[model samples]
Target: MSHYKSNLRDLEFNLFEVFGADRAFGQAPFDGIDAETARDVLAEVNRLAREDLAASYTEADRNPPRFDPVTNTADLPEAFKKSYAAFMASEFWRLDLPESLGGTLAPRALWWAIAEQILGSNAPVWMYSSGPSFAHVVQVEGTEEQKRWARLF
Candidate 1:
């Protein structure tokens, strides 16, 4: 056995079997998209995570990041910055948000499936990217202008 094993089989089993969360997308916003399309989005996001975001995580851990006391800025390694850009570019940041706010409202299970891959790769990175969903929740509970600001964030 190798240390680099991915739990893709488990992901598949969870998505298609076990919890049976695949049926939630049959109405309203999700009705326009099928399960296969959802799977494609997940696959593409995971590919980007492995090839781009996770590329520098080990090196980042080795070097860590240095902070400038004056500027109050953490000067992350170039590798980590590149990885962060790649992760952001995946648009994984916008999952589970309302379309009005430039997001695709996906099935919760599919959302969790993608989350597992991101979290497995780097938990902090996953949390950072999940801000949009949090913002969406806030928007729902906020006033109109506040909702606008949430979307902007």
Candidate 2:
């Protein structure tokens, strides 16, 4: 844990000062989401990454996913599961997704910045959680019926 650290300072500075992302607010697609709200979301996601996600890096490595014959699916280690649960509770995955898919529809810069906290905290988590991200993209480019189905993911 001591070796892991998140660059929230640079992130906020880039969003507000260097880039002046605040001006993007109160507009279509990004309406109702001001600078303060975006900052708050970033802060919370960072906290969750540090407190819950980064907390188990070493342990989760030792305990990898295993095969569950009865379920015919891989059972994620309890350590990983714990971290996954923490991430799911935060629901930060919706930050980058479109509003049609029940997401915030935030700016790509801010969305990816916030995502860096979670995915960078645990690389494996990003790989495992690719379903939602993929679903979001498909929902955006896919047909109407396909978008409806992607929502289930």
Listed in order, each prediction's TM-score against the native is 0.83, 0.86
List candidate 1 segments past 4 Å from native: 1-4, 143-145
Model 1 lDDT tens row, 1-153: 111234666876777788765676566767855767776777776676677767776877788778889999887778877877777787766667888778877777777788777776755577656677778887999888888889777
Error of 2 at 72 (Å): 3.3
Off by over 4 Å in 2: 67-71, 143-145
lDDT of 1: 0.72
Give the clashing pairs for model 1.
none
Q: Report every candidate's CA lDDT.
A: 0.72, 0.79
Model 2, 117-150: lDDT tens digits are: 8777887776666677899877878999988889
